[model samples]
Target chain A: MEATLGIEGGATKTTWVVLDAEGRVQATGRIGPGNVSLLREEELRALLAAIRTETGGQFHSIGAAFAGCHLAAQRERIAGLLRVFWPSAKRVVVAEDAHSAFAGAFGSGEGIVVIAGTGSNVRGYREGRWARAGGWGHILGDPGSAYDLAHIALQRVYDAFDATEGLVPLGESFLERTGQKDLEELFVYIHSDPSKDRIAALAPCVLESAAAGDRFAVDVVLSRCGLLADQVKCVAEKLRFDRPKVALVGGLFEHSEAYALLFEEQVRSRLAVSTVFVSRVPGAVGAARLADEAAEEHPGVEPKPSRILLRESATSLDGALTEERNPRSRFLDRKSVPELVELFLAEERLVEEALRERKEEIAAADRKSSYAVFCLKKK
Target chain B: MEATLGIEGGATKTTWVVLDAEGRVQATGRIGPGNVSLLREEELRALLAAIRTETGGQFHSIGAAFAGCHLAAQRERIAGLLRVFWPSAKRVVVAEDAHSAFAGAFGSGEGIVVIAGTGSNVRGYREGRWARAGGWGHILGDPGSAYDLAHIALQRVYDAFDATEGLVPLGESFLERTGQKDLEELFVYIHSDPSKDRIAALAPCVLESAAAGDRFAVDVVLSRCGLLADQVKCVAEKLRFDRPKVALVGGLFEHSEAYALLFEEQVRSRLAVSTVFVSRVPGAVGAARLADEAAEEHPGVEPKPSRILLRESATSLDGALTEERNPRSRFLDRKSVPELVELFLAEERLVEEALRERKEEIAAADRKSSYAVFCLKKK
Candidate 1:
């Protein structure tokens, strides 16, 4: 029988599920990562082949939401790959994992979704106008991600070690958990590894310390959560949703109740949000829903793939001169040398006019300046 | 026949002055720039030769204060070069221009001196102890320098051009003074000529606009002056000088009464300074005074050159581990695996003991957590 297939692919793993027209789950499978941006063309083909083997039954429609598919180019590449794999399928849809998460949380409605797992990002939607803020990768700006939380905890450990007083108990516990002999060894380990997920794995220790009344740990978590809340608020304002519903997605908020509660409280205190809740549906299920909705909306017609290229060439002065709209200099190229001289004289006259208009103000400033008067008298 | 020679060598020009033992100026000469850091070894030798020719009869002593002589190594290099140039001179002194400026203003007493010219730096002297702040070169720090001021003004012009509201009068003045057709052409000009002094030349326009009541210009100058004040305050605190005397040096302060007045007001308002005045004594004259003082103090013996090496090797993880004083990890290398396991177990036991000590606090935190209880109940 005809069925719709949904795939949720990330950096670590891929989940695939098949559902019949009535939304009944017919089959399910799991495999390694299929994030198109991280995979080579051959590796991506291998992943698609593996996925095709699992969801091999007759499929009328398919939707694949993959991690690292934030850019339109990435989404189009994934869609093109799916088209090659399942050419006979009536419709194939590809989107960023955020789109599936948004659909899963609010079902194509107006809201904001914040993902704070290994990395953090915020997406807001209002009547088809989508806006995003604070997804600047791990090195620059992930404020409330697990990696951020763990990194801040490690920084505190170093701070405590360098303080005039000895290490605090919270810092001592971080040392114990990591099997590190001291802060020096911890620095060595951090320098050697520098892996985002490996660093993120230490966030649990920070939460535990905060639960045990470590003031430093609590402050770290609270401040990071505040930053996350600010990201949501910024997206909400950009989308101009007065009281948008916000959904917190990702393992950090889903598994850690203490962190989730703190994050929710911080977000609500800062933003006039309508509702804030943890998303229960997985991204795979959201993909299936989007597929079903796309099939119903298009009714046998396939959607066009994204053609907009996002990346632009680096800026140069010549390019800037040609591109920038400057009304004052617009007629310079058409003018003769004598005309240019006249224009230059006119511009010089404008400066004189501006200065003349401000003569009284300048005189007033001179009169009020006791020091200037004193210096002039000395001269 | 016995005359002391003093030279103030900087990025723009070098000033050489010959003074008698009674502090009367006997001769004065000016030459090209001789900043040791900016010059080749041959170029520096030539500049020294030119100065020696100007003060040919120098017999008692010589002092040279050169720009870019901040480090002890630079000072020693300058002193060695002086010894070669005037071998029979009774004493040869070399110092950073800041030192001579400080001596000029305070007469070898305790005080703080701020030099705000093409670049900015702060020097503090307290009971023979010297301290410094901010002067981390142009790319890193120099926040209150004329280069910094002009650079920020240019940045604001671009910002206004990109902004929807369009350019302010301050930005207009900047564009006019630069003689650029538009912001795009200005960008081209800036990229073509990245000279620090050329960029610093635009600072007068900023000050002029600020005096003419441009709010943006006023803010920029105020903020930069505030940064200069902070540098002074930081140096003063580091040297532990209460109500320190302050000397403002450099051509920026000497030439611009408005900027100098505002800077003094901002500094005094922020710091409990005893006195603030511009140094009327040129750096070359201060160098002459230092030469005379050195001859009197040493009588016949020449001072040994600076021995301090400025550069250190880059930090490595292995170096850090070996250098850090951690008593607990000192004996780990001698322990076997079984002994290490035993040590690990002991550390684990310490964690348990520490947790046991805070058991009541942890229990109280758990009991008081209304959100945690809800989460646990939901689970």
Candidate 2:
């Protein structure tokens, strides 16, 4: 029996759907954090197995879109994994989740898409060329994103407490939310590996309060939306798009209408020509479409362009590029592709280290590990 | 602003009640398995803290009744702990949980009471004298207890799979429950510490099938009940109360009426008991009542009894004593109590060894270090 599998890897959740030839989902499986930047390859494979179990078997072809998986190297790594998991399959396709969100939002057309969950990013496409905005680490950017909103709200709450010299009612509320005793503890918690994302998720609750006329919280939300608009503006200006069509695709948009509307108002107010639209089709469906496109483009490649067996040559080229600095080339081109790739690879390592630290903090959490997982803040 | 605290410690749960001096419970706390045979004194303190957190605070004049708290040395150790927790309180009482159950069942009167949860035991009282039957360690006894039923079920399931000389349906079912591929994997998991308790819990689910009259499961339950009845018979025969009043307590009574009726009928058929009663008052309450009695019996004693505290001590002691040679003679025997107490001083080296082993396990638990006052079990 022929099957099509679509996987959507998010900062907080990895969702996958198995469809029969007719494109109707037979089963769906959901788990947390599948981005290789955040999860080990073995962890990703376990998630795939969970999907397979939910689907009842292996599929004929698969399409997977991942957050923080834009690099060509990651695509090849995933392709190899798919081959092992689906040896008899016809094809496999792997790509950046932005592409999936873009397709889901605008199909084959040119447009920009914004996604915000534990992390946030904006991507623009024009005739197969890609440009991007925001999604810098939590320390630098991600305004209007869940992480951005949460970060801002936490600061404001702390600021208010500090302003009152710790006499503020909100200090107790924050303590209740994080289960920490004071600012020092909260700092340790935030910087600790696997930082709590759910604490940041409370940004929406704060946003809701602001919408209900809580001036302090509303200011936090407004500032967050303004920052997100500025990020989108930066991408549009760089790409030289007169009136780039904007599409929103993420939990930040799908779950919160207030945040979406506020973001749209801010972006349109800043840029005259752009029109933002939220995507109706999910990212997984977009991945499925991309898989179909890849198969169409490369029809007769050995093992098929879209199919991969996970067991074949279990290692990949990424293993070779470790810390043996290309000293000669480091002096050659400062902004070369190799340099960019190395930076991402280094970032992946940093992210892994951070996640490990987060895991330790959460491992000590009694009975509710999921809550710790939910609480993790993605940069 | 003053309060009265009551505690009852049994095989299954150590319960604590804080009342506002009017005998109305202000807060209630429950902890499982207060048997000193299983928990070290330090482990007991942690359990007490858990109950204290649940109960909200310290209270005046606490009463505690503990299981397996027979020896004078054990009582003195418990007395010291109560004094520390309730120093400002007017009174503290400590006694055996059986007496409290007796009071709750047939207050201030003679009767027989059977208790079962993780372990099973029967206690009979006639004119202030008490006798106990069963409640040995899981390896030695504990028939009609959840632990015994669970143990038997596990063995049957294992034996059934082995008899097939390969994989059986039961093996497949067990694999499904544990998400394991086969018996070999299951066996490895069964040996894992946390895994044992999780698998044992599944046994009760199997008992539900037996209650519905699955022949194999029925036999398991009946055999367990028979063992329980035998324990009760030992105490009843010794007390020589022909037509003695009997009361039932614990999880077995609460969960399965059929099992309880069968046990009652078997006891009646064998021992010619006139009245069989089920106690609605919890064992913790009974323990508290006994604690009250103890403090009153010995006034100006610094330590006051706490229902939840002593049980925690008992559990900690049990975990500590697992590897130690029987020191029953050191603590038992009233005539030699002074000599034995002096020997304890002489054998301070042995006590030190036990404390080290306990510290190792606590360290291995790898969480926050806990505080405890007594050391009974070692590595």
Winning candidate number (DockQ): 1
Categorize the docking of model 2. incorrect
Question: lDDT tens digits, residues B2-51, model 2?
Answer: 56667766556676766554334455666777755456888777766676
- The lDDT leader among the candidates is 1
Report, to 2 decimal places, the DockQ of model 1: 0.01
Report the lDDT tens digits of candidate 1 across residue range A1-379.
5588888888788877776775555666778886655678898889889988777746887878877665555566677777788877777777777766666666646688889888887888786577776554554356889988987777555534432236777767767888987654554455445577778888888877765556777788888888889878778877788988787888787556557656766787787866565664556656655565563332222222211100000000001111122343345445543343233323444535544554454334322333322322232
What is the alpha-carbon lDDT for the whole of candidate 2? Answer: 0.56
Off by over 4 Å in 1: A160-165, A295-379, B1-379
DockQ of 2: 0.01
C-alpha local distance difference test of each model: 0.63, 0.56
How much is the lDDT of residue A229 in candidate 2? 77
TM-score of 1: 0.46
lDDT of 2 at A74: 65
Q: Model 1, B294-357: lDDT tens per residue?
A: 5343322222221110000000000111112124334533554334323422344453554455
Model 2 misplacement above 4 A: A1-3, A19-27, A50-61, A88-91, A166-194, A295-379, B1-379
